[model samples]
Target: MPLRRLLAPLGAGLLLLSAACGGGGEDGDRPEPRRPESSDPAEGAAELMADMSLEEKVGQLLVPVVQGTTAEENADLIEDHHPGGFIYFPDNLSDVEQITGLSNGLQDLATGSGAGVPLFLGVDQEQGMVSRLPVGTRFPDAMAVGATRDPEAAASLAGTTAEELTALGLNLDYAPVADVNVNPDNPVIGIRSFGSDPALVGEMMTAEARAFEEGGVVPVAKHFPGHGDTDVDSHTGLPTIDKPREEWERVDLPPFEQAVDADIDAIMTAHVFMPELDDSGEPSTLSENVITGILRGELGYDGVVSTDALNMEGVRQTHDDGEIAVRAVLAGADQLLMPPDVEAAHSAVTAAVEEGRISEERLEESVLRVLELKLERGLYDAEPADAAAASDVLGGEEHAAAARDVADASVTLLRNEGGVLPLEEGSAVRVIGSGSEEIGAALRDKGYALADSASAADTVVVGTDGARGDAEQKGLVADARASGTPVVVVAQGNPYDIAELPDLDGYLATYSSVDVSREAAARVLAGEVDPSGRLPVDIPGTDLEFGDGLSY
Candidate 1:
C-alpha cells in the first residue's frame, strides 16, 4: 500500500482516539504486540510511532496544566486537548492519597482513550518553594543543597524524590535547576540555583539527573542554556540575556553540556531572549537559532527538547497561542510545554503542514522522539499504579528523612562575631523580629525562653524572613541593641537586611526561611554544623569587601 493510503486509517484512528478519549490520546487504537522477548524498547516505540496519525503524533507533543481541586476538572482538560501529558502544580495536590487519585484518574482517562501509550505526568518538585507533592519530604532549597557541594548527597536526595514520584505513576520530574546564580539580585533564580559557580552547578545537576534516572524516573534539566543572570521574572515579563554568544558558550552552556553528557532525558528551553546568540528577535523558546542552531546543532543534544511553560508572559507576550506553538515546533522543540490552547496548537501545526510551512517529516521526527521517550520510560505496558501504592510513594518516611538530612547539612554560619552563637542552654533569649517564629521555636526547643524585651534577655535572636526591609526590621534591630542584650542578627532570606543592623553583636545569612533552612540555622546557631557554606553571591556593603565569601 502507498504510504499516504496507510496513513489514512491511522488518521481516522487518531480522530477516534481524540473523540473517544477526550483529547489525551487515551482512547486511541491498542498498540500492536511486538515479538515476545524483543529486548529493545526503542524498537517497540518506533513501531508504535509508525502507527500514529499526524494528529495523534502532534497530540503526543503537548503537555498541559489543569488546575482544579478534583480530577473532574483535570480530566476535562485532558479529554478536551488530549495533551500528551500533564504537569501537576501545588493546587492539584493535597496529600499523598489525593495525588495518587489524581495520577490514577489521568491514567484511567488515557487508557479509555484507546491510546496504548501512557501519559507523561510531570511536576516541578525542586524540594523548596517549587515542590508540588505536599506529602513528599521538603528538602532544603537548591542553594542550601549546593552548600554541601557533594554530588553524592544531591544524587541521594534526588534518588529518594524520584522513587516517590514513580510510585504515583509520574515519570518526569522537572528539576535540578542548572542555572548558575551569578547575580545575587536575581529575582526568580535566587536560591533555586545550586550556587553561583558553573562547575559546581553542573556537577550537582549531573548527579541529580543520574539519581533521578537510576530511580526509574525521567529527569528534565531545565531553563537552558541558563536563566541565572536575569533579574526579571519570566513568569511576569520577557527577560533578555545580553551576553555575547561567546560568553554564553564559555559560561552558560557548560551545565547544559554536562547534563547532555549525562544523558538527561530532556532539555527545557528558557523563555529569555539572547539576541547575541540569536538575532531572530524571538525568545529562546521560539527561536530556531537558539534551540536548533545552538542547542541541537552545535551542542549535539538529541534528547527531547521541551519548552518552558508556553503560558508564561515571557513567551506569550510576543506570540499568540497558535503562533507560539508553531514557532516552537519550527525552532526544533520536540514538545510544547504547557501550551495555552491545545486545540489551537494542534490546528496550527496541521495548518502549517497543509501550507508547507512545517514538513510532515519534521512532525513525524518529533513524534517519534516523544514515542521513544514514553517507551524508554516503560509507560507502554505499565498499568495505572495502585492508589495505595502511590500514597506510599509520595512524601513517604524515607523521602522526608532524606530532606531533613540535606536541610540540616545546608545551614551555614556566614558570620558569628564575638562568640555570640551556641547560646547558653537555659538562657533568657529574646526573640524580637518578624517571621522569627520558626527560629524562635527552634530556640525554645533548646531550653530558651523569649524575654519580655531586649533588656531582660541574656541574648536576642533577630531573624528576618527576607520578605520586607522597611522600618520594621531596622526598628527591631535598633531596639535590641538599645536593650543591651547580645543580639544575633540572622537574615533568613537574603542577607542584605543585616547591613541595616550594624550594631548587632553577630550576623548570619541563612538565605532562606523554609523549614529545612530554619533547621540548618538552628544547628549553625548551636555550633552543631560548621558554617562551611560560603556566600554563593556577594552580599553588598561598603566595608564588607567583595568576594569575601567565595571559596576559590
Candidate 2:
C-alpha cells in the first residue's frame, strides 16, 4: 500500500477526537478545541487533554528509546503505543541525513496520534565521552569548561550544541551535568561534572542551561540531588550516598538548585540511592521522597521530571522492567526514559490504572505536565526540520573556532618547574600517551619536531588521561628526566596524572582529550598560546588546590 494510505486511518483518529471528552459527538464527529486561543500553556494542554483517552494519556508519560533504524521499522510502535517522546542512542543514528529523516518521520507519526502533539526527541549530546549525535561540533567536556572559569564560554558551547541538535530535529539535550565532583575517584561522573566547588559548578551549569533554553532546546540539568560524592557507577550497581541533609545542601544540591533557578525546563534524576532522603534504599529514580518531596517540594521545580535510563543495573537489578516503569511514575517522574522493554512498561502502566493501583487522575497529572512542556516548547506548531540544512548548521567553522578557543582557555600549567615549557620550535620532542598521536600531529602541524624516540629527543612531552595509569609511560618520563632532558607532561584526562608523576620538569592539564583540547595542548607546547586555565578540582594529597595555574 502507499505510505499516505497507510497513515490515513491514524491521522483520521486524531482528526475525529472530540474537543470536550475524547469521543465522537452527536453527529458522529468531534468538534474543534473550544478553549481560548491564548498563549497560556496550561490552558492549551488542558484543552487537548480533555479529548485524550486513558490509554493515550498514559503513553504521554513515557520517553522510550527507539529500537529501529527507519520509520517503517518503528511506525507500528509509535502508532499503537503513543509514547510522548523518544531518545536516540548511537545505534539508531547513521549520519546527518539519516538522523534528520528519522526525526521527521517520528514527528510525522506523532501527528497521527489522537492528540497530534509532537514528540520530544532527546539525545545525550553532553560532548565529552557521552556525546550521541554522529555529525556535529564536538566540544570539550564539563571539566574543561570549569577549568576556564568563564561562564560565557560554557554558554557558547551549549548554544552551539543546541544549534546542531535543532538542525537534526532534536528538541531536547540531556546535558549541562550539574553534579559537583567532590570525590576524585568517582567512577562514572569523573570528567562529566563541572568541578568540585558547588558555587563554581552552579555558576557554570546555570550559564549552559540558560543558553540551551535560549537556543531553542530544552536543557536537562542531570543526576538530581547530586551524583558526585558517590564512588560506585550506577550503570553496573547502585551507588549509595549517606550524607546528611546539611552536607548535601552544602556540596551536592547547590548546582541543581542553581539550574532550576536559571529556568531549566527539565531535570534528570539519578539512579544512585540517597539513604538520607528516603530510607527505603531505592535509587532516586524510584524514590518519591527524593523526587516529589525534595526536588518538587523543597526545590519548587515545576518543570518536567525525567528519570535516567531504566535499563541500568541500579534500577533494573531490583525490579522488573514493568514494575520499574510504574514505580518511577508513582514516584513523580514525568518521563520514563529508555525502559528496557517498552511494551512491558506500557502494559504494566496500563494494568496499574485498570487495577486501581494507580488512579486515573494521578496518571493525568503527569500527562498534563508532559503536555505543558511540549506546549511551552512550541512543539505543537513546529515544522519538519530541514534535512538539507544539516551540513550548513553542523560542524561549521565558527563552532570549530569556538571549540579551539575554549580548549585554549582551559589548558592549565599545573606545575611548570624551571619554566621548561614554550619549547623551542625546532626542538626534538618525544610525545606519548592516550592522545599522543593526535597531540604529535597537532604539534608537527604547528612546526614542532617530534623525535622518533624519547632517547633521541631534547624534551619529552607525555600525555596522560584518567583511563590509564600506565607505569610504563611513567618510566619513560622518568628516564627522560634522569637523562637531564626536560620532561613536559600533558594531562588529557584527570589532572591527577601530574600528582602520580610528581617529578616532571613541567606539567599541563587539559581535562579532556577531544581534538580541540589536544590541538590546544600542542599549541601551548609550541608557544602558540599561553596557558590560561585554572584547576577545577584539587590534586588530592598535594598542595595543588583548585584555581591553581601558571602562565608563561
Candidate 3:
C-alpha cells in the first residue's frame, strides 16, 4: 500500500502512452495500435487498452452507478460490460464493514472481466453536504473552510477524507469545488463553493488537489467553467451564466487556471451555459468551443476532463443519454459520469467509432488517459479495499478531532453587538429553529444549560437554514428577539442570514449544517474556542465585505 505516490504531472507517462500507440491525432494517420514484438522487450501503460475490444474500450469511458448495495445486484456491469468505475451513493452503502466487503466483491467480479484494469470506485465525498459515504469524518462546506482562510485546513480536510475513502474501498473523489460562489442566490453551489473570491477559491482548491492525490485518492475539482454565478440548479434545469467574456476571465476562470497550473489530475465540467464563452448556446459541458477551445486550448489543462452527471436535466435537454455520450467525447471529455443508460451510451460510442464519426485515435486517447490515471494512482495494481482495517480507519477519533478543529476555526462571528456572545457557563439557554435538537444536544454535551422557556434563560439561541432562502428565518429571529432575554442566532446554513436579521444582538455564521460545524458553534457559544473565522463571501444586503468578522 505504498501507493506509488506520484503527486505531479504525468508528462513523460502520457508521452509514452502516445508513443506506444505509434502517435495518433488530427495531425497524422492514427493506424491501429501495434503490439511490441517478442524481441522488442518494451511495453507501455496503454498496452491493456491496445488489447481491449471496441466494447471494452467504450465501457472504460463510463463511470456508472450500481443498481443496489450488493455486487450481485449489478454483477453484469462489472463481469460483462466492464465499466471503468462506479459512483457509490448512500443507498449503496450501510457502514464501513459492509461497504468494504461490497467494494472487495465488486473488484473481484471486475478482475477477470474485460481488460481487467480495475474500477475507479468513486464518491462525492466532498466531506460536507455533498458527501455520499455512510461513515467518515464530517467536515464543513467549502465556504466554511474558506472562512478559515487557511490552505492547510483545506489540505487536512482532503487528506484525512481521502484516507477514509481508500479504507472503505473508494479511490476517486469529486471534490474541492473550484467554482467561486459569486452568486448568493445560486441554488446549488452556495455552501459547496469556496466563496465569492476567485483568488481564495484557487488557493483552497490547489491545496486540496495536491493533498487528496498525495493521500492516495484521485481528487477531481468540479463544476468546471464555473457553476457559481447561476441562480438555477443544473440538477433541475440548465442554468445560464450570461456574463461577458471579461467577467468570466476575472471571476470564474482563475481557479481553474490555478488548478491546471498545480497539475491537477482531473476536472469535472459544469452543465451551465455561458453565452459569452460559447455563443452557439451549448452548455460548457457539451461545448467544444468551451471544452476544447477554452479549457483545453486557453487554460491548457492536460489532465482528464469529465462531464458532470449526464442524467441531470441540464445536459439531457439537447440530447439523449446516447447522443450526450457521443457529444461529450467529441467535445474533448475523457470521462462520462452517471449516464442513465450505460449500455446504450457505450453502444453509441462504439457505433460512433465504427461509423468513423469518432476516430479510433479519439477513443484511445481517453482510454489511455483513463488507464494512465489508474496506473498513476496505483489503481492498476490495486487489490480490493481492505475490509479488516476499514472500520477502524474510518470515522476515527483523530479524524473527528481534525474536523472539529476546522469547524472551530471556521466559526465566523459576523455580528456581536452589545457583546451578546460567548454565553456564560451553565447559563440556561433556549435553542430553536432548524437542526435545533442536534444543536441543543451538542450544547448540553458541552455542559451548557438548556432552558425550556425563554424567560428562564440567560440567552435564547436560534439556529437557521438560510441556504434555502431567508424569509421565514427573519420571522423566527424576530420572535426570538421579542423575548426579554438576549438573542443569539447561529446561521448554520448561509452566512448571509445575518443580513436578513439586522436586529440580532449576536450572530455566528457556521456556514454549514454538518455535525462538526454545530459542535464547533456550540463550543464557540460556550466560550471554549475563539471565533477566529472571517467572511469568505460578501453579504448581499449588508455592507460587510469578504474579510469581515469579529472575535470575543
The C-alpha lDDT values of all candidates are: 0.73, 0.83, 0.81
Q: What is the lDDT of residue 405 in candidate 1?
A: 72
* Candidates ranked, most accurate by lDDT first: 2, 3, 1
Runs with alpha carbons beyond 4 Å of true place in candidate 3: 1-43, 467-470
Q: Supply the TM-score for candidate 3.
A: 0.91
lDDT of 3: 0.81
Model 3 poorest ten-residue lDDT run: 1-10
Query: What's the candidate order when arranged by decreasing TM-score?
Result: 2, 3, 1
List model 1 lDDT by residue over 1-552, tens digit each: 335334534543443433333222232333332222444766665676665556667778889885564455654554445568889887777766566656655665554442435688999988776788777667767877777767877997789888878877688999889998776567888788887778888999889998998887888898987899898999999898899778887778899999877778998999998888877768888988888888888888888999999999999876689999999999999889888787788789878988989988888778777877877777766654555666666636776777767766555555556777777767888876754777778877876787777777888888775534467777777877887778887776655565556766777666666776776677667666666665555556635532243110
Task: Identify the runs in model 1 with alpha carbons over 4 angstroms from their true place.
Answer: 1-38, 67-80, 393-396, 467-471, 495-503, 540-552
Per residue, candidate 2 scores C-alpha lDDT tens digits across 53-142 of 677788898788876666555666776788898999999998877787777767765665545667899999998778987788888899
Lowest-sum lDDT 10-residue window in model 2: 19-28
RMSD of 2: 5.7
Q: How many clashes would you count in candidate 1?
A: 14
- lDDT-superior candidate, 1 or 3: 3
